[model samples]
Target: MRIPGVPPAELAELNRAQDRLSFVYLERCVIHRDANAITATDEKGVVHIPAATLGVLMLGPGTSVTQQAMMLLADNGATAVWVGEQGVRYYAHGRTLARSSRLIVAQAAAVSHRDRRLDVARAMYRMRFPDEADTRALTMQQLRGREGARVRRCYREHAERTGIGWQNRTYDPEDFDSGDPVNQALSAAHACLYGIVHAVIVALGASPALGFVHTGNERSFVYDIADLYKAEVTIPVAFDVAASGSTDIGSDTRRAVRDRAHDGAILHRCVRDIRALLLQPGAAGPIDEAWLDEDAGDDTLRLWDDDGAELASGRNYAGEVDF
Candidate 1:
């Protein structure tokens, strides 16, 4: 007998991108399916999680997930990410929620055009420095320099408020422990932020590798998106956690970031910000019209036409092609 995959109606009932949790981290547990929910069984006990409500599932070291559990996660449009031992480093990610290619197409067009790309980059800087009036005359480099100064000031202020050491941001990528207490906390905090940002990016069907300001890395777009919230969310949280002088700074930082994400509705804000950056202004079409309201990841595939337009898929165009 064929197993019933997630029915289209059930998939529609799953939580929207903005309404879900930012992410959930699981480690050293056996993740298996239990009806509609997934269970994580450890030495202590089994905990049941409603898989449909889960946004991103981070599987860390020593975790064993069953096949049925994976099926449920995919069926629910929930992204599963394989993470490092501490749950900070990302190894890989699972399926995306989006089935339409509209957001990515818009993203590519924006990146390909120099003026549009610069405008989007400047808008990103504006998101970071909302109070900075009159940035229209500033170049990208100048904006970046100003942003750096602003971030530095944010760090110093947080340090003073939390009584944490105010030092330069320094970290050895190869060695997490090599950084100062605050730096280590910052790294851990940033990792959580990256995970949430990445989940939103993929869920929206946008390319994470294509970035406006950040470059090269596969997670360049993830970094660019996460930077919008660093000063307001991660930086202050990192410093506060560092000031507590917890032995398990990484774990503490993750929890704090998660709490902040919940309080700030980070996922919702992320969806809005990404849509604003990528979606074209005054774009016309069924797909564009559908997205203008909010993010709706319906599985509507279209065929690309040579004349820079899209046509409905699944049509027999042999006669038209011959002509």
Candidate 2:
């Protein structure tokens, strides 16, 4: 899957750090390898996508990517997601970045502990409402009440400003076409946000099901994270697009959502916020010499030999520790 013409050192560097490219949206395109670059060809023209620098690739309906192009994306740590119309509905996703599992272990430990889970939930609420003096003390019920009120107010304000008729937030998953343009646009915009947040969650090696405020679903954590930016990002865009009376509201909504994500630096903020919420003060400390030294001893568990053969010699018997 290695691209030719690119030096090994440069490829190594690209894999080692985050890429400058944030997100790319493509639809009805054919992606394949073109020498050292991954090119996407459509009716418009053929364009090269710097897979190494890309954060997320949204493959909308009708997109066909070659196996070579997919392998290149995985090798470069870029996430590829198959989505529905206007990148609103997520269908599937590619491999995540291969990174340390320590962060995920820490997250699991926190969520498994009952009190710690509540604390994490409170921390999430505090993050969403930093100015509220009682955020830390508010119970989960209180937090939910406040969040509901706040969101309703946001909908009302946006509706008044944009002159779009506002009603209760409603959508039928079974019938996407049933909703009005505004409701449909909102659904589309939120789906895009979820896709972006899902990529970050996977990149960090965190569990999407292990959420703080949201639970029971596979993308519980994705929803929890996406909610933080909905007010500032998708809500306004949905309202504005609906107000414009555009024929293709979904496409317009996607463009606006992408623009907001870039302008607001939402991905960077998401990374920082995730760390702040999960890696709280004193929850875990820096790795020290002792931690590294544990792996240096010969008594360390070895499951396989250098030649890929299973080694049963290391198993401990009734009274003896085999080495």
**TM-scores, in order shown?**
0.92, 0.82
Candidate closest to the true structure, highest lDDT: 1
With a 3 Å backbone cut-off (N, CA, C), the pairs that clash in candidate 2 are none
Q: Report how far residue 14 has shifted in candidate 1, in Å.
A: 1.8
lDDT of 2: 0.75
Query: What do the candidate models score in CA lDDT, each in turn?
Result: 0.85, 0.75
The digit string of per-residue lDDT tens for model 1 on 110-152 reads 8888878888888888888979885666799899899989988
Q: Write one digit per residue (lDDT tens) for candidate 2, span 1-323.
A: 87674332223355422233446788898999775567989899999977776778889888999988887777777788888876767777877563455556667888888777777777777667767765656688998998998899999999999998888899986666788989988998898889888887776567878887888888888998899999999999999999998888777888888888888888777766666566664322332433322122233334565787745665555565455
User: Candidate 1 clashing pairs?
Assistant: none
| Model 1 lowest lDDT segment of ten | 282-291
> 261 in model 1: Cα distance from truth in Å?
0.4
How does residue 100 of candidate 2 score in lDDT?
55
At residue 170, what lDDT does model 1 achieve? 93
Alpha-carbon error at 33 in model 2, in Å? 2.5
